[model samples]
Target: MPGMVALRYNPILKTFGERLLASGHAPKAVIGATMRKLVHMIYGIVRTGVPFRADFCSQKLDFQDGI
Candidate 1:
């Protein structure tokens, strides 16, 4: 699951939703967006042959050359 955050109004969600709309996403597209993120996370684990670790963290440049 994503990092924890308290429920509160945030302009980013509106902005993101607007972008999704512009890209032809329907009102229920949030589910798809979330699923896509999950798929990416799973793909990352498989691509690197690594199991998920709670403390896992890396910068994009860190693996530019492939570990």
Candidate 2:
């Protein structure tokens, strides 16, 4: 089932879909959003040498007592 939807599309779409899936996004408009995030992540990692941290995502993280 992995790559099932992507395999049907062109290389561009496949790449977009995979990026979308990797970024925890799944929806009809995932391609565009994923592409944008990919650009930002690439700049952050390559230009700044920083790893992507889920906790620092635009979506705020939940804090539990006594972590």
lDDT tens readout by residue for model 2, 1-67: 2234443443544555655566676664564554554566568889878775544542322221110
lDDT of 1 by residue, 1-67 (tens): 2311100122333333345556676645644554454567679989999887533443332333211
Each candidate's TM vs. the true structure?
A: 0.39, 0.38
Error of 2 at 50 (Å): 1.4
Error of 2 at 6 (Å): 12
Cα misplacement distance, residue 45 of candidate 1 (Å): 0.6
Predicted candidate 2: what Cα RMSD to the true structure? 10.8
C-alpha RMSD values across all candidates: 9.2, 10.8
Candidate 2: list runs displaced more than 4 Å: 1-28, 58-67
